[model samples]
Target: VTFLCLPPVSFLLLPHALALWACTRSCPSRCTCTQEKSCSVLCDRINMADLPKEFPCEASSINLDKNNLKFLSERAFGTLPSLKSLSLDHNNISFITPGAFKGLPNLVELKMAHNEYIRYLHTRTFTSLKRLVRLDLSDCNLFSMPDRIFIEQTALKELLCFQNNFRRVPGAIRGMENLTHVYLERNRIEAVAYNSLLGLTSLKYLNLQENRINVIHDEAFKDLQQLENFYLNDNLLAELPKQAFKGLSRLKMLNLGGNLLTNVSKTWFSDLVELEVLYLDRNQLCFIEEGAFENLTSLITLHLNSNNLTALPFSVFQPIYFIGRLYLFRNPWECDCSLEWLKEWMENYKLVRDIPCASPSSVAGLDLSEVVYARLNGTCVDPAELNLTTALPDNPTTENKFNILISKLLQQELKEDLVNSTESFRNGTLLDPAESQVSGGYNGFSTGRALLVLLSMYLIQAETGPH
Candidate 1:
């Protein structure tokens, strides 16, 4: 009796359930809909060159992607008042006229990606959708666009111009005030002109990572005060100007890896106060001046692996209060008493791994982490020269003169020890420029070291002259 009564009620509800499904699935011919609320035409490879004559006017999202439509004319969307999204991805569209989407005032998202032929667009093509938030125009092979194409997209937050044929930072992004993330990687951008990024004050993430960027003007990043993450790796950047990163005070992660940067200037990182991670790996870095990282109070991780650093100044790491992870692998570290200060500092430091020595063949493959100060002190030990057994002078003035002589001798030895160490890479053995180019690594460095040793030794000898 219960089953029989349930069927009667079920039969009555079958039409209502069908109606609900029909609201999204009742698509017009050559198209599908989910009960008329959303619809998609099965236009992929169907050779349907034109849009279906009728689209559900009340549908919120209509997927017209993968169609063979070639061009978009004025009023092409025919006053779509309720159409909030339209996808034309993978289509063969070539051009868009002014007022092409004349009536899409409430539209929020428009995806026109993968349309390789859609290169030409009028400045007013997107003028109808003032409420547009996300626009994906990537992979369109567009060489250029009118500067004002995105002037009205004030609320746009994400603009993907990735893998396009842009010659530089597109003029369209200059005015998109609310943008927070911009991906312009792998474009043909060669230079970052001054004030090119001026209007994007609200941007937080900028990736110019894989372009032909060789020059960055001093004022290139002056307006990006709020920018946090910046990626500038894999470019032709040879040198960074002093004011290149002038206004990016809030940047956290700066990736300068994979370039031809030879020196780390003291002023390079003076402004990045909130920075935590800095990547200077995979570069041709040869020298880092003392006090280079003194201002980076918040830096926790620094990567200097795979560089040409042979000896680091003992006091260079003094300014950093906390460094949890430091990578100095693959560099030629000359192990000797020159490392005495570093050994003492490392004992107190947290990380004790991956630091290897590349010099003094006996310890070539040894990890510097295991070596102690006692072992390092052995190589630089010198015999005491002052003979304490000698009779003291009876004159008080004579005694004071003897003490002064000993002081100068000790100071001279200390200076000579530092200059003699191969850690400085100044082995005055430098060959002629032509020959040094052929014998660069060890021979060229040894030549420079020889010259520095001669000059420093002369100075030391003069200080203890005729003692």
Candidate 2:
């Protein structure tokens, strides 16, 4: 009976062994395959024009980076039925066929960054990645985004398209219900449309920094019920759309620094009941409307440094209830009668001690916390003669030149003050004795220069006589 073992069973074993040996030798230099219930393949930088048709990747992850692959055919990736994660970063991939991600249903993360040749992604290219949570398309040289680029990526939670070349935020992106974080910074967007952000109800953090956005529509952010952090810094915006941030009920931080705004009213932030931190530094704002921030009761930090403001309204700080710090330096705040309101408010507020001016001549080194507003009314007065007028040509020009020169001289002085502030805060001397030296040196030099220029002009007039 042992000698009679069936020849048919023995004949089938020969071909099975040969088939297994063929798969192993197909790409001995680039891929590895191991049989453990299901075969898996590992290929790093294969640089093939197309995926190997016979590669058995039933349960595997493929990494193909730093390759010269320029296009992906429609069914190229569909063959990798079990690929869970794909890394095609740093490739020269320029074109992807429609429905490129159709076969990648189990993909969790897809990184396509640094592929500078890819400019536009078709609407349904990523529709098959229903389980994808992280999609990084940053630095891809994308100049314009299609309206339906995210139409089918319903499960997407994080989308990073930073450092692209979009001149305007695309009309697409209206329906990402589960998206939590979106990074669109460092682009060329000039205007944001209202319909562009209509249906994103679960967004929490959105970064729009370093763009060229000049206008933001009022209804652009209407339904964001859970938004917390929004960044719009480093743009060319001259003004906000009055109700630009109307419906961000859960917003906590907003950055509007590095813009061209010249003024803002208290009502501008009246609806942000939950806003905490606001950055308004480095703008052309000459004034803040008296009640512009009255509604931001939850605000903790306010930055208003490096502006062209001449005075602060009397009731500017009346609405803030819990401000931990207020930055009012680096602006041309005239220490005059018009600034009495700010002086009074600072006297009543406990956190008014940290306000330091970039120019000693501008803020006079008065510790706003120690100086009573009533006393400051008489002490920090600017005489009527200092009032600028067009008729005072030589004087105004000379005065401006003096200010510019002295501003440059005191550049390092301001940095030293900021440094000392940290050291003093640590040593229990938040305000040290050296603060008293802020005055006299800078102010006297400016005043004496103006007087000397005025006297010299008079002498020149006497010698030259009337024109």
Candidate 3:
């Protein structure tokens, strides 16, 4: 209380200004430093040759994207003890030492995507980040991943690695117990191992669309019991194995458009009772089996455009009465009389949206709603319509005359056979043309017409007897 010596007001402010200057000096070069009472380092277009040794990011996040950062020290994030999020994306980072992220245990999100040169990643790089939730390495020019890249981060939920050149999904993701979503679309994946996703029980959505998956081994998705949306569009899938979607009891939407499927079997998708939307456009399918969608009673929307189909299987859509929309355009639909049933069913159900034609060969000027399938029921006209009758060289008569003469001979033979055989034409038990007044009954074609033809043929044969 007795010592009250004051140097000056400016002398007290000088030390505060010096402390702020020290925070700025510790930040890396080519980065903007913001200071209020705390310091934050924001780097834009910065050359990340090395991490600043004295950088003090104990109270703020850091942005270090779009740089020519080639390498990082083993403990590059050692000084950022309180950094919440770190962005080192779109850089030329090719190599990282064994322990790149040695510190910064509080990091929540890390974005290192779209870096063409950052092809390699070490497994233990994120070992110290216990609280890391979202890890995005998308579009990073990565061809493969270490098996145990995320084995230590059991708390990770979302992993986004889409738009990359991965030959297969990382094999080490089997230990992610709490993982929810995995996005790996637009890659070059050919095969997916069954045990590759062994431990992801809580996974909900998996997007493997726009890939080069030529084959889907049986039980490829055996462990993904909770998966909902599975997209496999724009691939080279020619056929689906029976067990392809075996364990996906909750799948909702499936897009199989733009593939090379020729035939679809009922058993291939019989277990997906909860499927709603199915896209089958732009394929080579010609015939859809009758019971293909029998078990999928919950289906609402079905797309079948741009295919090689001539006819829909009989009773294919009869069981799926709950469907709302069906797309059948741009297909070679055979619009014959057999389509009468389809037209009637369509009219009954009022399914008019899926009635467009892709070409003139099927429905050129006729309206699908106005036209009835009964008009196209008959086959081509009979060959008798053409005058191409030939005379048997041995018999020397036209087929029509020969047929009549053969009929008379058959009648005479029948009469002789009845007389010689135990069965007699005299009894009422026999079929007799004389006793029956009903023409065309069990005896002949037309009532009087067939009798006259047979009688005239017999008269001619009687006039020219043995010859």
* Clash count, candidate 1: 26
Give lDDT per model, in order: 0.72, 0.69, 0.71
All models, RMSD in angstroms: 12.4, 15.5, 14.9
User: How well is each residue in 1-467 modelled by candidate 1, as lDDT tens digits?
Assistant: 24343334466676555544434444557666654334333334455577665555656777777778887877886766777878888888888878887788888889888888877778888986889888888888888778888878888988877778777888788857799998887778888988678788999999888888889888788878889999898888889987677767898999988878888988888898888999998888889988788878889899998888888877877787787788888888866557656766677775645768765554566666554322111343211232211222443243344354444444444445466652322355323435544655543334434554555555566557755
Q: Cα miss at 29, model 1 (Å)?
A: 3.5
lDDT of 3 at 292: 88
Q: Is candidate 1 or 2 superior in lDDT? A: 1
Sort all candidates by lDDT, best to worst: 1, 3, 2
1-467: candidate 2 lDDT, tens digit per residue: 24243234455575554434434554335667654434445665667555555554454556666667788778666555666667778888888888776777788888888899999788767767878888888889999878877776788898888999988766666778898998899988888888767778999999999999988887788877789999999999998877778767689999999999988866567678898999999999987777788888899999988889766756775677688888877776555555656656677765554443222243455443333221211353332221121112233344454453344334434445565552323255333233533533433233334554566676557557899
Residue 119, candidate 2: Cα error in Å is 1.7
Order of candidate numbers by TM-score, starting with the best: 1, 3, 2
Instruction: Give the number of the best model, judged by lDDT.
Output: 1
Error of 2 at 133 (Å): 2.3
